[model samples]
Target chain A: MSTAIRDDYLEKLIESWKKEASPVHSVSYLDQLREDALDRIESLRLPTIRDEEWRFTDISSLRSMPFPRASAAPLPGLDKQAGTFLDETACRLVFVDGQYMSGLSSLADDGSITVCSLSELIGTRASIAERYFGQLADFQENVFVALNTALMHDGVCIVIPAGVSVKVPVHILYVTSRKDVAVYPRCLLIAEPGANVTVVEEYVTLYEGASLTNAVTEMYIRDSACVNHIRVQRESSQAFHIANGSVLVAQSAHYDSVSLALGARISRFDQKIILAGGNAECEVDGLALIAGRQLADTHTFIDHANPHCRSRQLHKCIVDESAHGVFSGKIMVRPHAQQTDARQLNRNLLLSDKARMDTKPQLEIFADDVKCAHGATVGQLDNESLFYLRSRGLTEVAARNLLTYAFGGEVINRVIVPSLKQRLEEYILARTRIG
Target chain B: MINANSKVLLEVRDLHATVGGAEILKGVNLTVRSGEIHAIMGLNGSGKSTFAKVLAGHPSYEVTQGTVLFDGQDLSVLAPEERAQAGLFLAFQYPVEIPGVANDQFLRLAYNTVQGHRGKEELDPLEFDDFVREKMKLLKMNPDFLDRSVNEGFSGGEKKRNEILQMALLEPRLALLDETDSGLDIDALRIVANGVNQLSSKDNAMILVTHYQRLLDYIVPDYVHVMEAGRIIRTSGKELALALETHGYDWIHANDQATGAQP
Candidate 1:
């Protein structure tokens, strides 16, 4: 745990901020908040391997480099590169190199839904953005969130009215196309009471050079509302992606999230949820497929502050070649949160002898009348199944790849959207060499 | 069945296989010609399953000293998939549950691979579905099994039937069924035996490996071989199964010892 990496990066970041000055927004309070976030980042510094939350994942490599703020670049034929999930989405907000691309985005003019860039929202509906932004994700404890808060200039802001159920999903595509640069993308989502909506945030990079994407999303689910949040990270093989998200669920609210990681040289995602209301339900599903010198880590924390709440989490990883994966999930039941039920499971499959996985599923129950259980397992593919497939005329490689695809399909099958599921299946098949 | 013009489909000479450095098949020798069903019956731990697995090229078993010839080709040089493409099929006692792979897809892959090896035309999904449905009727398998994962969450009987369904689709020249009747009920045994009977023909051969004499009754064998300590010590006609059923395998062991044979 060396401070040299932090001091070096801190000086570079401060120098860049001095050159660019500060971002201008309609609300002066947000500018002050950004300054406060910068101060918070300075105080918190970057977490090293000594930190318990980052014990398995090392960030010294990220801190050692100088990733200046990425400038907007023209992405030719960007419209042709849109993914399969874009067609079925009701609305899509596209961003390239951390800058919003209005020409490529399809934002319908509808009064019931508010989907716009955070910068525009700051100028237009400053009051609404002022209420929800910077509320859920705590910048003081998380350095990535603090960095995103301090440096983010544009992102998506989604606000759904009360008692309305949106049938189609809304997607936000964060595409990067530069080398040796960093981008900060921030998202703020607010669902009023009884509102139901599904929001997907996808991160993909087109370039083959090393880049860093530090993103933070804050979601607020009001009383009795339902919100499904999905984060798909399919960045370039040379990219480094670090995302931090938080959800604040209100009384009887249901918040479900699925975080899928398929590419990156080094990727880490941390999501925290606070069950502040009684009878709140949260389901979190995650899947990471890493191979060939890649390291992907997922950390989640669910805090049950009220009684009669339930939380379920299932995270899986498929590691191959010299790649590594880490999963650390914790469920905390407060002293007064009686009758709380929580279950957590983490499963990993190592496809090669050189591949490795570290899993820690923890449960801290303080209440007496709570039911909590957690389990983790790491193993290779079943020998019987491999032999079975081989005996049926499949080559050894084909058998292994088929089993790997099957292992990953468990999480993809949970996606209710047929088109997204099909697209994800194709991605897995191509990556795992199933087809 | 005993004609001299019949061609030998499988020949095993002094087959000795080991798993984890422990020999399971100790000098097992067997020969089978086309158009014959030979039953290998023995007690538990007598290497019945090991022989079947070894013949099927299971990676766990190392053939320390053996030679298995399938249709005049040396089986030692081929991989498991190659052995399968060469028309050697084994019906496992416990079918594997491969989740996320539909039964129809698995069956089609196997069928196409075999067809490719034989230079036959492969069918598309819809055409194969129709063809497989007709074959499934022989085993009385429901059509829903095609959509489900291969053997995943299937009952014991259903798994056995699925194995038989695969056997029907493959149409191998030599088939080895390892304890296929162990976990099945009487009704399942009857249906499985009926399917085997329908699939048997003059152009193919079968080796039924089982512990019970009951399975032999349903699918009558031309010859019954008693395996003791991994070696076929006694070979007799089909009536030998009836004798073992009534007097048990211990009497044979006692007679072998009385005759001063190797214990």
Candidate 2:
């Protein structure tokens, strides 16, 4: 009944990591990956609030702050707020607190995509960074992804090449500079066979108090590849965001994702899509616009393992004021995944009345010639389509912000990225004119 | 021939309404002047679709006692979109469908929200696509239903000719219709009664709410009434809707509950 608490901030992070003097190239592989994340966080256990996947998300206000350990400083005027999706890019990976600035990154001038730094791909390609770092993230069953692989410094790797595609997209951005800081940022994308790419991950925050962002993204997508990922979290409302994305996809591959969680005071996003082969395709779309007292949690897993795979999930939430929205979507399939055509939809609107939405859509079909479906809906705002849009002269706050932007514009007009769907319809019409 | 100073619009009065708590319009009175059309009929719960969804501010019906007024203002303090931008219009017996919105952008946002409540100047989407292609050629509709969606997969006579092409592009001064020919078929109820008689004029006005008399034999109603258990016992003219379509509302619900009368 003892879970070792000999803490004084873990003895000042173990006497500042035994007076640091090694990392110039594998100090015993960073001391065996920080003693295997402190022996898997002192022998796995923490996940309390009655677990069921961290029931309604409670890390007791993130184990009461006190974060530190992310310092490389120099964030200075975030290069004029890193705009043109991080200025004239083809490849760009910035980071800032979770290390890797490499003088604000930029690579691909046609060497068929490699974009460095994960400590220069583990100090000069250590066997392709030991066959893909943390081999597709599990971190002994996530505790902020084992504290983001126990404070893994420097991220971004990206690969591409085999039958190349790469035309543009690749921007990575991270940010979060100090003030109660905690930034973990880790990303490793691979592609290969018949490769094609598009990735844009942007999470900001250089100031405006309180912070914590523990991110991890690992994607593979091989055979007949295609990947279009866009995660844009506009942090700092006194931040706290936890993001985890893992995708595998293989045969006849295609993996699509569009997640846009507007700011956070608390946010959780975990997306896992496996599919693993046979005509694989996964499309995930998400939009969140929570207001004051914000809390957004979106968890999705679509595994369908093999046989004629296909996965589509649409998530939309726009909870206002007393904001709180959580959507859990799962679609399994498996049994020799026959003709698996999975679909999951979660829709929520609830604009104030103490806004709240908790939608769960699950389908664990053991393929009987599968074609699974999962749906979740929590409503409000269709008082006959808000009196058919305020009898056509839209005023009740422009007909409830045009029917909550046409209910998250049916997954932001299924974004095929027209300048990120006109900057997510002008950031959801400036968050419905500040609610 | 409506024109005693050509206005009055909609009056209502003894109104009374209700839905799940039962009492469906029991004391109904009515007016609607300017270039009339009137109709009403009755039968199935004879509240004529709860007085056209309590004159279109349907919050699951519950008017519970009079006062509607209209053109001379006071519509129970507005709200069904400010009684549809103050000119009032109802249409639906079913209508809804709104999938992802576009039937010509919901009739150009209900004709620029009734031309921005009559102060005018709105049009744009290419002059609202040539003012909705001349009101979708007066309800013959189909310009590929202005790129689908609203009234979603249409048909029930293309959602009653897309509700008379949104009552001829929101030119309302009181429209109402309701069971707009419930599931039409006599050639889509004579093309949704000639697009509600070419958008009635003199200053617009109509009510209609049928139960049959074949949609007042194609919009020929200068007054019909009828209703039952919930007022309007029986008013006349348009040959009392061809005598309740050949004597039917069970002899006027047995002559108004056998003269303990209340029609």
Candidate 3:
């Protein structure tokens, strides 16, 4: 059976993929997964405004652009600027245009963890790669994820052994510098039982260029394992960024994911956490600060599949000028997932009259003995509060900026690492121009 | 104590202001002298709060015809912060709540801004914290109040005390207290009034805008004026406040009608 592709973007991407003549070592498992993803993309097609999930965010602009496929061409005389998490991390991995840059990365010789490129890992540790790759993320319904799985060539792979904890965070910097190029980057993380680790994945565009990044990440946490994942996206204002992150948590395991988006013409971050075992916990937090004509969207899902699970999520957005922001979150409690406690909140602050926000919080519970609550609020700065601050000798701009930063600070304050927290605060302050 | 011959700190002449296109203050005139604690007593809708807000240059109030001179400078030409820097302060009747900013940070920023404007050395956070703690003690405020967000989850009396605490820190030359004693209990009222009395000096002046004269008993204003229909119709010494307290504001309303005051 064959299905014809209707999506212009997919068709152009596939045509480019077929024309690739470079010799790349391929594993049978990933090849099959890629084939499956292509088939799924062909069947699903691109989502339009008719779809419920794509109602608020329009992709017509993306569909009109004929983005060229980017390869692993060496960036000549390209300079690498330090990232936000550069100072504290001993292990750092750098990627440019979806391909790993070996010269720019520094791998720690620590025995407790393993860090290598995905393509290298597929050759050296094929069994472990095959066991966990393409397991957590779903491509059947998510066209972006399917596109990423089909087109992605290489990314970062991290493995933490049992009963080991890395004191410092591992930083992965993904930089894009090509014009009108489409890039797909993938990441996979596996934490063994009793292991603990924190990872920071940052995406940035080096120059002012129009690019598309469809990234996917998968994580698996065994029993009693703890993992803190931070994803920061500060691409160019002319770029489009769409990312999907999926995590699987086992018994007594803990997973925390925080995503902060401060750039991009249009960006969307989708996060999913599956509590596969009892007594597991997950916390998902996000912040999006967009100005001018940019649009930032975030969607999160937490599934409580077993008993005694807890999930907490808080997402906030500060929009200025004519920018628009959207957030949709869902917390699901299965039939047998008794004693599940889940809460979700979304707050938005519109800085201009033309700014807009759409938020939806949903709770679907089948268990009778579960507690779940969800709320959403969209408002502008308080007039009285602004006046009060000005009365206390704060400039009008300073007063507005401070309140705006405080709105996003709720999510930033949850970070456990001090340096990262301080860096995030400064980054947010500079971006918001509060100082 | 105030001398009638002292320099005038604030002068409002023929002031007429509007809010949402409706005039609230009509031809109101008053003068505040240095070292004077004056009380403006009136009923609700008598434009008591509007008068205080207009003097603070609230954005919502538009002064159509009048001039407010502060230390002989046109107060109308200054922004709220500029007015605040030029020795003007207003303790809001309803203090705004800021949920995330700590009380200490807010106070220190205000203090530093005023200090900078005055060409004086500013205190860092550590030094300001110590100075503010001592001031808070004057209001009987707990040390924990410094760490919490400004007015967030604070009781009514606590909010009132926080407003006075700011008044003490700012040390403005012309301070306007708008119903600072309304929500406070007797004890909180005494503590807040005492704080205001301690901050009063011969170089500055205080204007207490309230509905009842009960607060005047504690602050001991040198002059008390009766405001009606957006203008001061009667002015007398502090003993007049006690007379009006015994008999409600109805007589003031009647006297205004008999004398054909502005409608």
The alpha-carbon lDDT assigned to residue A140 of candidate 1 equals 81
Which stretches of model 1 miss by more than 4 angstroms? A1-6, A21-25, A82-85, A122-124, B254-263
B2: Cα error in model 3, Å: 1.5
How would you order the candidates by TM-score, starting with the best?
Answer: 1, 3, 2
Using TM-score as the measure, the top candidate is 1
Q: lDDT by residue for model 2 over A237-308, one digit each (tens)?
A: 878888899889899899998898888788899999898999899889998988888888989888989999
Worst 10 residues of 1 chain A by lDDT: A1-10
Ranking by DockQ: 1, 3, 2
Docking class of 3: medium
DockQ of each model against the real complex?
A: 0.73, 0.21, 0.61
- Give the number of the best model, judged by DockQ: 1
For candidate 3, the clash count comes to 0
Q: Per-residue lDDT for B54-76 in model 2, tens only?
A: 77777778887888888878787
Task: Please give the range of 10 consecutive residues that has the lowest summed lDDT in model 2 chain A.
Answer: A5-14
Candidate number with the higher DockQ (2 or 3):
3
Inter-residue clash pairs, candidate 2: A392-B113, B233-B263
Candidate achieving higher lDDT, 1 or 2: 1
